[model samples]
Target: MVDRPLSLYCLLLPSQKMIHRLLTTAVRGLSANYRDVIYYRVKGGERLCRTPFAVFQERESGKLSPKARAAMSPEALRKQFEALSGKKRATYAAAARKNRCEIDLRRKAFKQASLSGFSHFIKTTRQWTDLGRRAKEKCCAETEKIRQAAKVERDKMVEMYYSGNAVKH
Candidate 1:
C-alpha cells in the first residue's frame, strides 16, 4: 500500500472509532510523520466536533455562510444594538465594562507576579520571611493597589448596571 498523507475530509468520519479503525488497519507500516498527522488530525477534529455549531458550519460550507457573514457585519451589529431597549443597552454596556475591568485586573496581576517572582521563590522555600522587608512590602503594596482598583471598578460597574446609566467617558 502506498503511504500518502491522509486528507482532513477522511478524518471527518461520523465516528471516532471509525477513524481509529482506519488508522489501525491502513496506517500500519506508514512513516512516523504520517502516523503523527493521523493522530493529531483525529484529535483536532474531535476537538472541533465538541462545538456543535462549528461542526455544523464545517459540514455545511467549511466557511461562514452569507447569512452568517451578514449577521456579523458592522451595520447589522449597529442595527441590532439600536433595536435594544434602553435598559438592555445599559446592561450590555455594564457587562462589557465589567469584562474589560476583569481582563485589565488579570493583566496587572500577571505583570506584578512576573516582576516580583516572589510566588516562585515562596513556593520553593516555603518561607515568606526569606524575602527581604523592602521587597516584601513593595510587592504587598502593589498587589493591594491592584485589588483596590479592581474592587472600585466592580462597584462602579454594578452601580451603572442597576441605575441604567451609561458611562460618560
Candidate 2:
C-alpha cells in the first residue's frame, strides 16, 4: 500500500463537506499538506501566510485597507481638486475642453469621409458616368459640410484657449 496522506485521499474523492473542512484547516494554518499552507518567517519566529482561498475570501468580502478607502473617497477627490490654484485649474480646463472639441470634430470628419456599404464601389468607378457623378457630388457635399463644422469648432476652441476658460466656467 502507498503511504499517501489523508488530504490526498480526500482530494481524489472530494465531497463538499470534506473540501470545505480541508480549506478551513488550510486557511487556519493547520493543514498537514505542505501545498495547502504558506509559511512566513518574521523576527526568528515562523508565521503562517494567507492561503489562496483566504486571499480570495478577503477580496470577495470587499475589505480594503484604510488608505485605499480614503484615496477613493469623494472628500479626498475634492481635496485633490482644490489643491490646484484657480488660475492653473482654469488654464487646464480650457486646454482640456479645446482638445476634446478638436478630437470630436476630427472623429466626426473621419466618419463622414469613410465610404460605407455600396458607397465604396460606387465612388471608385469612372466619375464621367451618371452614377459616379452623383456619388462624387454627394461625397463632396458631405466633405464640405464637415470642413465648415470643423472650422467653426476650431474658432471656438481658439477663443476658449486665448480666454483661458471653458464653456461651463
Candidate 3:
C-alpha cells in the first residue's frame, strides 16, 4: 500500500460519532443555495467586509458620511436647495433642523404627511379626498380577506401535525 497520513485513514473509516457529525454538516451544506456557494467560491471562502457605521466620534471629526457627501461644497448645496420649489425647500429645511442625520429629508416629509392622513401633501379638493377614502376601504377589505385565508391554512397545518398526519417534504 502507498504511504498516507494516519488522519487520512481515520477520515476514510470515521467513527460512529464522526459519521453523525459528518452527516449533519453535509445536510447543512446541501441545504445552502447555489448563489451562496458561488459567492463563497469567488471570494475564496472569506466573508465580505462589514460597512462602518457612523458613530458620534466620526461625526465630531468633521468627516461626512456617504449620504451627506453631496452637501460637501457650499455652492453645490445652495444650488441644490434653490432648485427645489418653495414648499419642498421649506419642508427640507424643517426636516434638516429636526433630524441630526440630515439625510432623507424627503422621506421625513412623506412620513409626516402620511401620519397626518396626507393632509399637507394632498390637494384640498373634495373629489380627491372621496376617491382616496374609497381606495382605502377597498384595500382594508382585501387585507381582511387575505388574513382570514392565512389563519385557516395555519389551523389546518397545526391540526395535521397534532394528528400525526403531517405531509412529507
Best by TM-score: 1
Weakest 10 consecutive residues, lDDT, candidate 2? 34-43
Q: In candidate 3, which residue pairs clash?
A: none
Clash pairs (backbone) in predicted model 2: none
2 or 3, greater by TM-score:
2
- Better candidate number, 2 or 3, judged by lDDT: 2
- Which residue pairs in candidate 1 have backbone atoms (N, alpha carbon, C) closer than 3 angstroms, thus clashing? none
Give the whole-model CA lDDT for all candidates, comma-separated.
0.45, 0.43, 0.38
Query: TM-score of every model?
Result: 0.31, 0.27, 0.22
Per-residue lDDT of candidate 3, residues 6-125 (tens digit): 544344424633543443234433223322322221223321111121222223225567667754665655565567687765554444343333223322322332222222212132
Instruction: Provide the lDDT at 44 for model 1.
Output: 28
Top lDDT: which candidate number? 1
Off by over 4 Å in 3: 1-131
For residues 93-143, could you state the per-residue lDDT of candidate 1 as single tens digits?
664565455445533443333333344333334344445888778766765
